[model samples]
Target: MINRIKSGIPGLDEFIQGGFPLPSVLLVLGEPGTGKTTFGMQSIFYAAKRGEKAIYMTGIAEPVFMIKKFMSSYKFFDESFIENGRVQFWDLGTSIQTMGPKKALDAITDIVRETKVTRVIIDPLPLAQLFSSPVDYRRYLYDFLAALRNLNVFTIIVGEKADESAADLEAYMVDAVIILYLKSLDNPLVYKNLMRIRKMRGTNHTRDVLSVEITENGMSVLKLD
Candidate 1:
């Protein structure tokens, strides 16, 4: 069998038997300050090392410079990566502000066509959903995924969870769903981070609730407690 495209995300790749299948939409869900954006950025940087063209698309208010600053702290985010045309950034904040998800999708499609991106990340999709209904958001997501699949690109969509309902539309639309949770432990009086591979279509993924942490270098997957 052909080895899957490994994301090189420490333990994550091993959990998926390799990594996400090519041309699949992987949902990375979490609450605020849980490192979802960092994880997605690191994934794009990892892809760039393999000579893949990557696009970091965001729906948040964060400026590209700020994203690059965080990414630059990691060894994988090298200047040559951008200089050599391996990585790019696209901010959808303004587009989502002016147009809706449908139009925003058109803008995204135009970027993909112009860049031949092999890996793409969409940070904090809730903003895009604000521009449209849940049903319309899901439809646009499906259409976007179909377009990405046609282009043979692996896509990562980030979502912030206000509640379980935050994942309803995405869980039904994407090829894979990864949920990150933060729990308080009374004994230690500390908050513990956890991640679950809620689902991954067409692959035997690890169902264990694993721990995660962010460092000056970047996010790392820790062992399940």
Candidate 2:
């Protein structure tokens, strides 16, 4: 049987047929306001609840306190998870901007080395482009992914669809790719939240895009009939 890391997201698990494979990278691509950050938080929360250590690493607007605050509103997030030390958060925004790619890589290396991070979420990795050129960003991602492999951490690199090139670069670099799309249909009542498994290395993934939604509670997926 193939070992799968349960994501703990309702409908999503069924679509992936379990969860993400262990020790692999998954790219979560979406447009702005498409629940990309929320999806990452939920992934980390699920891992932490399952007695696995999870690390939330962000290169964008998400800060430590803010993430915690928003997550707290969700039933899955609580003080015990924090006090018991199942979850950790790191913001690379300032470090990446000030120290540059090499130093930023060092910072990332230090965290993975120090923490027992079974699941890692790097929110909006495209932000790395702001600190370095496209070529340099690609180089940094390659080296970073290599280091993650050595550490054996399952990682999620979140990206916004602001630039098509950035998304293509990330898809080429990661072990798996998941794209979230919001579509508005012609009918007034027609709308949809869809997720497609673009690629997952060494495993067969579903081709049809699955429907998903984000209500006041959190995200949910609906397996296609």
Which candidate number would show the highest lDDT if scored against the true structure?
1
Local accuracy of candidate 1 as per-residue lDDT tens digits, 128-181: 447446666667777887888778778888877744565676777788888887
Instruction: Say which candidate scores most in TM-score.
Output: 1
TM-score for every candidate vs. truth? 0.89, 0.88
In Å, residue 223's CA in model 2 sits off its true spot by: 2.3
Root-mean-square deviation of every model: 2.2, 2.3
For model 1, the superposed segments whose C-alpha errors exceed 4 Å read: 1-3, 127-132, 162-165
* Clash count per candidate: 0, 0
Report lDDT per candidate: 0.78, 0.77
TM-score of 1: 0.89
Locate the minimum summed-lDDT window of 10 residues in model 1.
125-134
lDDT of 2 by residue, 1-225 (tens): 656787767777666757777778888888777777778888777788778888888775677788778778877676777787788878777777788767887788778878878888888664555644888777877888888877888888887663334457778888888888777656568777777778888767788868787876688887655
